[model samples]
Target chain A: MGRRSWVGAGLGAALVGAVGVGLLVAPAGASAAPPLPPVSPEDLVSSVMTAQRGPFAGEVEVDNALGLPAVPGVPQLADGTSTVRVWSGGEDRGRVAIPSPDGERTLVSDGTTRWAYDSRDRTATRAPAGDHGGPPEGQQQDPTAAATQAIATLRQTSTVAVDGTAEVAGRAVYQLVLTPQPTERTLLREVRVAVDAETRQPLQLTVLAQGQGEPALRVGFSEITYGPQDPSLFTFTPPPGTTVRDAPARDGEQRPEGDRPRSTVGDGWDTVVIGQAPQPGDGRPRDGQDGQDQRPEGAPDLSALGQPVSGPWGSGRVITTAVATVIVTDDGRIAAGAVPQQVLTEALAR
Target chain B: MTTVSASAPPASRASTRSVAPLGRLAAAEIRWVLRRPRTLVLLGLLALVPIALGVGIALTGGPGDGDGPGLVAAVAGNGLVLPIAALGLALSLLLPLTVATAAADALAGEAAHGTLRGLLLAPVGRVRLVVMKAAGVLTVAVLAVLVVAVVGVLTGLVVVGGPSGTMITLSGTTLGLGEALGRVALVAGWTIVQLLAIAAVALAVSAFTEHPLVVLAAVLGGLIVFGVLAAVPSLEWLQPLLLTSGWTAGADALRDPLPLDGLASSTGRALVYVVLGAAVTVWQMRRRDG
Candidate 1:
């Protein structure tokens, strides 16, 4: 009888343990008897993206105890771009350095291509059309594209439910709850978003972990604009004194038929397509160092070859030298192809 | 033959009486623990600190960026807080009192109550009784440590929210939040193990002294001596050998990508302290004359 009772107890304990595990592993939404309405991922993306385009403006307040001051009078550019200029109020309290007072980045996009320019770097880069890996370096994220991608990715990896309506940034929005799919890469098992019901723009977002814990991110926007923007705002031009280099072609050399110049000084000269003439301290062979060398009569000093460039490329000097050609794509994709220098010249000439 | 049989019954009765005293002794010891105000206080305080720290951190604008998992990584995440803050509130002030208070009464308090001789006369074996007492004390210490850990972590989470992965500033690399929390849990566990070593040391001190005050003084003195030795930079090589060296091993859990340096050595040292202290105490108790 005792043995039989022990077996019964063991079975009971096992049953309890199994139930507890199930309760933990079960999706939060699964407890409801009736199934809710299914949300279409594509529709959600379109709505969020559509609401993101605007001609609006407002101030954003950022509070960082690590010496980030509250930036007031921050301007939101007409093309949905935002800019804030901060100054050293008094002594440096160790906030991360902003390049300069004008060290602002403006993000502009026309439903399709997106571009971001850092006024301090004097460089602009664009996002690839239709690609989801996000924009290249120097380009700003299209808020609409980012919102769309975030929603799509979340939907693909989670069971989502509309958690009713709420107000965010003074706008009425729909609240969403997401439960994780078995193969999700995120640590969060659930997330909530306050999206504008009519426009589909996300007003606020929050991520919650599986276990009892605090929310990971709580971000709310100040103001959002929706409507058509000036078409010319999307176009970008290289600043004066800036060099525009053509992306290198695949084969690492210029095709003979291309209209680009072919220097007799080996492929290295071809690789030098659009940079400024060398300056003093550049570490290149000075005109007197190699008697065989000749150049245009008022050529800038070539001595500064090994010296760091003063532009954005300076930080990436090591990477540029190791690769055959460095091409900054139209959408700001920085790619290094094994193509020859002559091919880069030809591609740029076109 | 009738007389002999009658005498044998008395012998049997005496043996029964002897065994009865063992049960009474065990009951009395348990009651004493239950009545102890210090033990209750220590347990209560340990549990409260983590919650308090968590709330404090949260109200203070949350955990600082450097205070998060990533900073722990840059320093190799050994989990030991400098100055022994890793003990949370216990090491800060409560732990020394817990050790001293429990062990001080081990032998001396019995003598003070004039029950030392009665306890020695009991049928219960001396070595077994001492071992049991030590076990009870160790249990209390372990409980205190556990309370601190659960409370501290819960409070930290409430204050700072969930762990965000290690923030590698230079590389701008981040790990998953769950991984960071796991690291924090591991650090808390290591701290418990370190506290267990201190408990063993206190138990050993208790076995040698009959005065509770002397035991308390000895345990506290030993801790202070070791703490002083730890602060001497020139004796750095000996730091890892100290039982207290591994106290902050939990700090290792805060690293984004966990670092294992010094962990093995610290754990080994703590284990050695526990084993050696328990062994010596058992030997002494077994050989002690009633």
Candidate 2:
């Protein structure tokens, strides 16, 4: 081999080696915390809650370590990292797009009208913007919304403290940690919100379960651009041929007659939402089910998921995720919360 | 080198006059590759995959009540996604195989045919020869992706988009024709870059072996190994180095408002492969005895 051959080999080796080092170095570089003035936890919480949200767009990534089975139809409930593209023009104008492997589910709100479209089913649900569609799912929940809601709901029940300052999505942030009080019965150990130091916006939210080294669930902005977003982003119209259904004025809560009313059983941090699991062949038309009966073919069997447990409350299957547990009683009651099995059972017993 | 110089004067003068320019050489290489019956057959066969996929989806009336996992299952009459979905499917194996085959034929096939010695004996520098061959490989990659994309898009628009030619994006928003085509172009362009990276690897392997089959085997085998490594959780540290790591990142082009992060990282990775592979090819060519 000539000297030129050696040189070329060296150059090739050097270039290829750089790629590996770069991948390793890039992530480590982001870990260096940016310096910022310290703020008390109470002030950080209040500022986050009262912050005037400016128009912005960002891609949020949710990492779920909930150990949930990947159900056939409801991919949102699967345990994995999912990305959501969100744009907000203001409080009342917003859009959220969650891209699956082959399809997307988009929800858009434009002050007066709200549209939720699923490309897989080709169905679009239109509703009044003011109608509460309930809290967004874990994957679709933005850090700002989830953090603020947690702070507002769990502040009194938890001990709040400023752990330190860190950088999230290149923004300096204060780490506000909320730990449940000693008497509080909950599965979650602490809820950490990364509040932007300058703008006071919550850039990241992480929830850890008891004794877990890693966060059970984390929702954070991987990339964010703050400015007046494109107004068109907040508006949506179902494409021609899409099945457009008008959601009832009450957020699609028109349940079949004689169904037990849904209720919450506990306070913040351990609240169990108890409801009736739709019975097989129930006449109720479920959301996004395409009018299929309950337990549609290929839908995951709930009994196959966690260990079976029976108690004074009656026999049921208890499925446990990293941060929450769900008990489906044989009698058709479903109770779920971020509490231990005992809390769920007690909720069911009540 | 001494013999050639001693016999230089008239031979060199006549040969120099007759020798084609670099551009002509590259054009000839590309034409030769495109004219090959095997290449044409492969491309014609590749074009059928999308048509088959689209027709199958249309016949089945798109996704069934059951949840099926596939690009076809997610089409739901959104014609714009069909081409992208087709490109995505082909990228996994078919397109890469095509690019690798062309790259193998570029160097190893020529060497096996004894034409490579004539090329080396010519006055064209070793680097120029490598560049010409790389251009040939690139041409094959571009044509392979274009055939799939154009055919798929046409099928999608006519069969699924209906006569309106309207496109619904993966973001669930309707897209204008111009913008939708631009998105498809973006996907097609990104896919070409990925295949270029694969071609570079094949060429590098081809440079070392006289048998084209060896080049094809090495490239495809390496890809399979890379795929396995990417799936292993513990080998995640090796992911960034694997050329196959972010192959799916091209789908991000179909997203609304467009995300460049995934595409950027994957492009950077592919560029690295191109540079490294080209370097290796040049080095081996430099050391080879004419």
Candidate 3:
């Protein structure tokens, strides 16, 4: 065949594909998500859960639009885009750096010793392996971190669906949409995940909240490179003259620092974590629980702390602040979240 | 006479071929920028911010945690942070305004002073004027920031006298004195890059007007508008497009796993502005009566 005719056949196929895309591009104001394929919802979640995660390093754009007021910790969880760089050789050894206006904070796991360093604070903490929460030893989680965590955490609460094929980071992906079931009573409306077509690992996660027109949060790699990263990034030696604190604890034991906050309730997307408040009646932190409980001699008086409020759920007093809203129900249960006060009241009922 | 290939090997060859002409143009531009008293005064004012900060902190005992983001806050702990603080303050508005005024003045100042005819009257290509003027403004900016960094270090040492070897990074990783210094250079370079977008805007605005003050005010107004728009939550989607949004985000270089995404996007955003702005500036200048 002549070169022109040979090109004609290729051009014909591209024309057909272009027509198909014209049919597929949803009308403006519809949604960024395309219509769904015939795949089963159960299969979609399992496919995402089992996605292959090879050793890789890349930078991800974290755009948070949750509109939550700045909480005391995790202050940057608001309407803005920040950058996070992650390097993981499998899961046993990983490094993630999240930079703020001041400086960056890095959490590095070198197989045996896991280090968490806050450069702004000039403090480095080294703890034994499996000391605190992190990836299980050698689990493969390349980029679907939010997806994987979401799948496991929201499996019981969300109605999963296969939302069809789309492109993310310029690669073909299958969109898995998860909507929280009504009983979940979560502020979140829907979560759309883009899973890599080849590796099946999630490439991007978009979260939409109730009454919000835009994605509340999106965590995805704008750029990525797969392969082993430099081994030196996994190993860290605190710069000379740094204040190094070793947090060596045997398996299942808490760190030497006493009274670290813990959630009495289990963990999940809608999990209500009630930190151990000062002893209910005694007006002091529970210092006697551990020898290292270093509470100051005079704890702040908690009497008449919560302001009064009432609703269909019940009557309660809430301590409202810029960061968080805490509801101290007359029944003695405490609920808190970065969410609005109504969400917190609903959680109390749940 | 010919478009040059950007490949490393070919670029080197092309540079060697045009070295004499380009070198003379660059020398003339650099000399023009350096000889300006206003440029010297601008740099002098920037250098004084850190000294005033250091001395004030020294008088007040030291910085408190309540202090906002800057090297001044870090000065209490490590004098090395002075450069960081100085650069931080400059990156937001000061550096860009400085660069914008200088860049605007390059072409507009000449026109205002009635030197446009003399400059164009020479045997210089219009494109070469744009290139030379841009080069001149950038040199001044680079020198200005370097002064801020050096003066900051000197004043920090004199005032705080804290051990300056360690750098507190955002990612809990400690940067040695050497690496920290290297990062300061990277940050300063990135700030120049971010400022070029403003300069490009100034350059383009300068083309439309002959009065240097009008050009300066127009560029500064553009910056203020972008900052205000970025602050509005309703316009948050346009933040990435705003050169002002990520101007100082390059502070990420100090972090362990550098936020290449932020740094790259910030640079990429600035590049887009520079390309479009420079294009208009050149095109407009090429069409001018001079």
Residue pairs with backbone atoms closer than 3 Å in model 2 (clashes): none
Candidate 1 accuracy as lDDT? 0.47
Better of 1 and 3 by DockQ: 3
TM-score of every model versus the real structure: 0.39, 0.83, 0.68
lDDT of 1 by residue, B53-116 (tens): 4454445543333334322212212111211132443663576567557655665566566676
The true-versus-predicted C-alpha distance at residue A188 of model 3, in Å, is 5.5
Per-residue CA lDDT of model 2 for A109-179, tens digit only, reads 99898898877777899988665755346336554566566666667788888898888887888998989
> Ranking by TM-score, best first?
2, 3, 1
Q: Which stretches of candidate 1 lie over 4 Å from their true place?
A: A1-350, B1-31, B62-89, B157-160, B163-185, B287-290
Give the winner by DockQ: 2
Q: Which rank order by lDDT, best down to worst?
A: 2, 3, 1
Model 3 lDDT at residue A289: 33
Q: How far in Å is the alpha carbon of A189 misplaced in model 1?
A: 60
lDDT of 3 by residue, B147-173 (tens): 888887777777755555666565655
**Regions of candidate 2 where Cα sits further than 4 Å from its true position:** A1-8, A20-25, A133-157, A182-185, A248-301, A310-316, A327-337, A342-350, B1-21, B49-70, B73-82, B153-163, B225-239
lDDT of 2 by residue, B30-134 (tens): 888889998999899999988988888888877673265556665646677788889988998899899999988988998999998998888878888999999
Q: iRMS values in order, in angstroms?
A: 18.4, 2.9, 10.1
